[model samples]
Target: MNATDRTPADLLRSALAADPARPLVTFYDDATGERVELSVATFANWVAKTANLLQGELSAEPGDRLALLLPAHWQTAVWLLACSSVGVTAEIGGDPAGADLVVAGPDRLDEGLACSGERIALSLAPLGRRFPAAPAGYADYAVEVPSQGDRFAPFVPVDPDSRALVVDGVELTEAQLVERARADAEALGLGPGARLLSGRPYDSWEGVSAGLYAPLAAGGSVVLCRNLDLLDADGLAKRVESERVTRTAE
Candidate 1:
């Protein structure tokens, strides 16, 4: 990316321009033995589709609050960017009762149902399959997202200075989000094409920085690992060697 990039979406656009074919986010679920890798173009497509789903189907608008009740998985990362693309404020672990919409994992089905607005349930299953049956009062994300347009254009332009994210009571404008991410990238010594292996959840500032924003700001890639506690040190070392990881953050 560049110093001028303001939002997470801006960082993504830069990454798409710089290396569309390079792997952007590689995911690993140690307990489930699941591995998925998305190139910039592929990740962009997922973001576009999910953004369409949010805007067109859920009627999500700029400044709308989205409660992200999900684990640190690849799909959760996609949802975060999709919210940013549509100019929605991503609220990490926010209360469903206060949110305009809720995108939830299986474990949070009850919390999702409590939300009066739109609710989308992710199977978080392999290949992003739909739940056997939709959760009560919730749309199955895997079912609805496939038919949406592959290209996304926001109905309203996102303002870089507008509130874009809220994590654990801390609100940040898009510009601030990018600025902190870039600073974190520098602190981590990330350079162009750097590959990072991050075993952190996105519930806090440091985890979000390491797992998502930092890599984008630095023009790098991330290998995001969930259930990392299950991986032995030797196994993780082997993965780092094979994935050519340039840096690591726990």
Candidate 2:
């Protein structure tokens, strides 16, 4: 881990600086037969745009709580980093009623509506498509995110020591998150160039660590699989070989 990396966003920046073209996130949805790969640069770009949307359009300030009701998809990863970039406290599967903002998938719109603050809904469709009919009282993420600036510059500096995430009622500051990610990386035997395939969901700290932070802190990459149980043993093995995965967490 780089000494300069204090937050997850910093880790992503370091990864982008080291190798813009290197694959950082490879996502698979076995239920949909969808595969999407994002290089460090590409992932950073998405984070930047989403960060801009959060900070500019949504007027999100540091310490603001954002209830994130999304699944373990690439876009969910993007939102996590975006929240880190702007110092928003992301709450995975958190109650929307108490949040400053709510970001949800189409299936979670009803739950998200409990938040009187800003609300954004994602289609979670292949290619990030827009909903045929936009959900009422919530902005369409796929429609709005594309128009956001490619570069994000926070009006207020993010504090590395500020709360950054809450998973399963456990709160972690940005610095703590980085430290834990590094520790998890070491425990998982992840090193440089290590590729970990994770079939875990995003509701728990372990799942978040395996799917995003651990490999990131290790200067490696992750193959995030959704609905992985549906894949046969042969198919899973073939995928491991094809993706060059060195480790797995399920």
Candidate 3:
């Protein structure tokens, strides 16, 4: 399915139908520092609950802004899908002055919280690593999402030519970006159960639209390398081989 035609729910449903037993994400736990695996069905439910949070509980709207300063990890997957299901514009440090929501980028957040103040409304900082909890005042991403559960209001049909993601004032229609990504995956010969790795942060919608969503939309698997520094050349080579990754989108 095309980007405008596709939803995060669409991808999850497709993945499950294709092979419910297949491993959708084989994540390396940065917290406990262990390797873990999740099936397509499991991830589908996780994504749905996330969507429920942002849309049902948070009251996020289309064109509303959400910032992600999160490290690349499994929860990153949940948030990206959450944004899509709600039609909220997810950004990564594009315009601190105009942002309605903020997360992760602590310094930018501090400045934004003061600058935007009332304009800067909700903040989603999921806890991990040195961060123990939701940083006190900031709303908890984990608590917000899963608490919302799986049921949600019906999704709005996204405009094919509409801009779905933003970064530094650049606005590319969801169709344009997803089409480009789909073409690349086809040319690279990605297929069912194929694994894709990206050496970049998964917080941005790019990683979802162009990476995970594209592949699973085409019945392929998406794996993320959250820590690049942790994966040097040798480490990367071993990871791909071990994970059976067919290609990478950097």
Return the TM-score for each candidate structure: 0.98, 0.99, 0.76
Scored against the true structure, residue 85 in model 2 reaches a CA lDDT of 97
Which structure among the candidates has the greatest lDDT? 2
TM-score of 1: 0.98
Q: State in Å the error of residue 97, model 1.
A: 0.3
Candidate 2: give its CA RMSD in angstroms: 0.7
Residue-by-residue lDDT tens digits, candidate 3, 132-235: 45554455554455455655454676554555566545565555555655665686577666788765565455555444656666677767655556656886
- Residue 224 in model 1: lDDT: 96
Q: Would you give me the overall lDDT of model 1?
A: 0.91
**How do these models rank on TM-score, best leading?**
2, 1, 3
Which segments of candidate 3 are over 4 A away from where they belong?
A: 1-4, 7-9, 29-36, 105-133, 168-170, 202-211, 232-234
Greater TM-score among 2 and 3 belongs to 2
- Higher-lDDT candidate of 1 and 2: 2
lDDT of 3: 0.59
Q: Report the C-alpha displacement of residue 121, candidate 1, in angstroms.
A: 0.2
User: At residue 123, what lDDT does model 2 achieve?
Assistant: 90
